[model samples]
Target: MALAVTCSISISSSSSSSSTFQSSQPKFSQIASIRVSEIPHGGGVNASQRRSFVKPPQRSRDSIAPLAATIVASDVAETEQDNYQQLAVDLENASPLQIMDAALEKFGIHIAIAFSGAEDVALIEYARLTGRPFRVFSLDTGRLNPETYRFFDEVEKHYGIHIEYMFPYAVEVQGLVRSKGLLSFYEDGHQECCRVRKVRPLRRALKGLRAWITGQRKDQSPGTRSEVPVVQVDPVFEGVDGGVGSLVKWNPVANVKGHDIWSFLRTMNVPVNSLHSKGYISIGCEPCTRAVLPGQHEREGRWWWEDAKAKECGLHKGNVKQDAEAELNGNGVANTNGTATVADIFNTQNVVSLSRTGIENLTKLENRKEPWLVVLYAPWCPYCQAMEESYVDLADRLAESGVKVGKFRADGEQKEFAKRELGLGSFPTIMFFPKHSSRPIKYPSENRDVDSLMAFVNALR
Candidate 1:
């Protein structure tokens, strides 16, 4: 079921398309300074900033039209369910452009292209090739690289379309940063940060559309996305009328290879992020992403410290199904080998488990007999899990020393108090309580290796 809007295009200028594009293009700095907080909750384009992004000049029948396509949504609720499985099978081997055309014709304004400011610009080119009015939106995670921000500006000039930008809620961002500091995700897993910055904003953006197009492909991450269908009912997100089957996802380039995407971009002369030329294949937030080596997979460049099997952020959690070994136990900790309990995972002999009251009591002590080293952690946190072995080793080495090693589960019910007083922002926050003072010293670095942690305890103890 589709709600269509026919947009009228007009030519305000008779100048050459190239000259008009060059002259109208705004500087990258101008686009970089855009205040995403002003864009509202779901997504919106600011009227004053609209002039900087105008339609492309007239082109040949094969090029993007010089006219801009405006999309308006219908208030009608979607009630019909299409045979997405059959459609996926039929379009299993179709070209990217053909699949894009099909999606536009079927969903129109109800659908939007999810632009990642990467090679996915090819999706916009294909949408233009179909001459259909399409909507485009992106998540401004506030931590994107400078080159990506510039590319956003370039695409606006090249396509003559204003992108609807979505931003994370200010309260959530401020809370995370204020309690944990800016780079907390480096020590803990990236899930919490990505959830706050990327996934939640994307969720808000998708709520306004019935269907959304993506540039996902089987070649992107073989471990997680090996079975991406061309079209399917979105299992992860909801639409305008929010429910179980209220949304549909169209992956037009699901079967296209990465090299072919770059080829299409190069051939079409589409604007792309400058980081791609610097060996960074899969781009996300600036901190978690890096350049890959010669033979490494693109996913390797993102969250390089994490295990290969669990590379995906929470945005695409639906793509990776959990097996027994990867499933969480009753306490939400990963039950590796299907038999380990929560106690077994944090079963370091020297590390004392502190309860909420216990931690409160420790904080009230005017003078401690021995210096205390405590870790504020959550069982479900992969970052906490990643540092488990090292923390245990540190505890063992410090057992003979005067320092006392302990851990406090600061998640769930106690999270708010931990945030307010215990300096808990992300998982596994380490604090050192000195021998003569009640105040505790917080660990500042993201490095969680054994030697670094050992040095922290040794220097304090």
Candidate 2:
């Protein structure tokens, strides 16, 4: 026997509309309760396995106020692992429209669609088709093109819904511009500017939502996003509920091709940024984005001055690995002050300084009982400077823990030696080599605090 489920979705604009959908499938409540790993990955379940949906209590949008203004409490309940697993399976074969439908039904006013005046506007149309109350927002990076702002206005008028404009904090923007100048990204990198302008505003926007939908597609950048999943937990940012694993991010079109998105936009008469006609495929800040040649990928038009791997602006996945590797590969200037030598920098208490010959001699000490925690750092790197005090404190504390701590300066006469022996690719790359292990284990966590550093060292033992 099959169970029947009914959902009534109401969307109010200048012209109000209401719609009802009925399906003979298990309710989201049941799906949420089931464990994700238990579900088969290949196919849908039999009709007899379906469970009925019980009408859920409803609350008005006014009562569900926005949580964007405040830091979410850390104790908030996290979404169940099973719920994420089941949602992924249920939506695996679902279309973008169906995915939006399920998202709205489950999360209600708590779900938002992120718009960047790009092809992602297709998600806005899909939300409207659901006839459900939903939130739409965009990051208003101060450096956006005039055409993009005009397009935002057009989308607002066409949908008859207010698109919340999230702006960067005034103080943060002023400080960055003052310190780095307007075009410092050209000299340094796009990460710092993007963090101040784009990332911070988006984080503020996301703090109010339980789930968010983006227009990211796997084909957009195969190197960076080849395995974009239809739905997954956002690893970097948190939702209104600040608990770990509380937020769900939906990339409904992750599997959709670029051509399909364009086709839908044209078919639906969707309003788009006028820049598309000027040969710009992927639109970003005016200064950073440009028109690409016929054969270039869409992202090639963004951050065109940098290497392809460093194109991302830190809004989605961070370009940490790329940035770190670039920094270590001689992209940054090395400090050559006569005041500090490799021996002077690494001579802190409880820390042994290792040269190329010293590192080679470590192979002879393979039978040594205690393990070693080594740090390869460059003096000019800001991350290394910030971590210096904590690293020293960590060494002092770990003196009695049977773990040996050491340091190496990778910027001086030993630069080539450090690069050749340690295979250093980033400033302050930490590694742990257990006495018995043949190879060293690179520390993976970005946290540079002393407690976190000690915890990492302790866990290896």
Candidate 3:
């Protein structure tokens, strides 16, 4: 439960920035100047001390330039960074209700739960259980299912709380539709469409708040969300503060399982999306979601046409950690010369790093002593990163054999050439160079696990 203490913290704002909330509600400019503080953890301060901590200096006429807004934001982030990190550590194993309590306590009404109109309704339930004042918000992508829209209304009626709806800019949506049909995502990829409809609107919504809670669970997507922490500084989107590390993200149910979430909802008699009963395990926009078959993982229903390893809709880019791909020249400094440094995974002894010239020479197959197996990959690609461990293990197992295991960096300047000749339609394209034929055979399956890759190598060799 939230501590019984009250104070005030002021959020910085601009004159023209409009409220994402309903028109009947006051504009952001009106409400942004003052917020009630619900005691943060062990700390309790009267209204004066609270003002000293978070309330920015008073600006005349409620008009601050963008540059001034940025400075104010930077100060707030620096002041709260260490405290939030410690808070995250302390709440590592805390229950969803407890974490939600802490979030509500710190940010108060300045924080809002990002309700996804799906299973994320559990977050609202947790907040209600905490008996704390909370705000709820959702992105209206204009493409959600009719059932999901109805469920949104049902949630509003059940909770008696208004949901602030964020929408994409009209011109942007029109531009995308004019250039390409509504279903362009089906032909190319979902990222562009999702960026315009969901990610941008969510970004706009978050920019008006100090913190936001999410429904992310570690078990939701093995490739992307497995390491979700209970609390952390958001790595992707900025908040009202508007800078890197300026936003605090709470994943109260990060440690919880999907089955457990459903159980809690059932036990509490919480309302759920009607689509859940129809087997839509992970519901999203109408076109992107579907009913899964028995025993299939929930996320398999989302973006089913794309690689499962890269299923995120870009709302939580922070969850996709790419630190392993950081380029450093042994001393964390870039090489003075024009050469790009390769990551350690590409430099392993068992897996030879093949340059474009080396790959071209191998294609000749003249006086070749051993067959070569190589993966054309880009380090930045999530699918490529996902299979790195398995690929390295397969290379280690093949080290004794005469076959040469190698990797060719096929992105950046080399991407077009790779597509033309090396069958590089996507990241981490695997090809086998046989002993006799110059033609390189492509690995046909999406299964990139160690056992499956080893079997493919063994059969080909």
Candidate 3 backbone collisions, by pair? none
Pairs clashing within candidate 2: none
Using TM-score, give the best candidate's number: 3
Please name the candidate that would achieve the greatest lDDT relative to the true structure: 3
Worst 10 residues of 2 by lDDT: 49-58
Residue lDDT tens for model 3, 58-107: 22221111122323432442243234555666777777877877777666
lDDT of each: 0.70, 0.68, 0.71
Off by over 4 Å in 3: 1-81, 324-461
lDDT score at residue 139, model 1, on the 0-100 scale: 84
Native-vs-model 3 lDDT? 0.71
What stretches of model 2 exceed 4 Å from their correct place? Answer: 1-81, 318-461
lDDT of 2 by residue, 1-461 (tens): 23222222235344543332233323432222233334444345333222212222222232122432222333222432334555576667768877777677667656778889977889988887766666788888988999998999987777776677788889999999998899999888898999999888887777666678888887787546766777777767766556455567888888899999999999988888899999887899999988764324577678755644566687786213344322233433422444342224445779988776766666346575889998887654444655777888889998898999988666656667666766665556788888887567788765677888888898987
lDDT of 3 at 191: 95
**Judged by lDDT against the true structure, how good is candidate 2?**
0.68
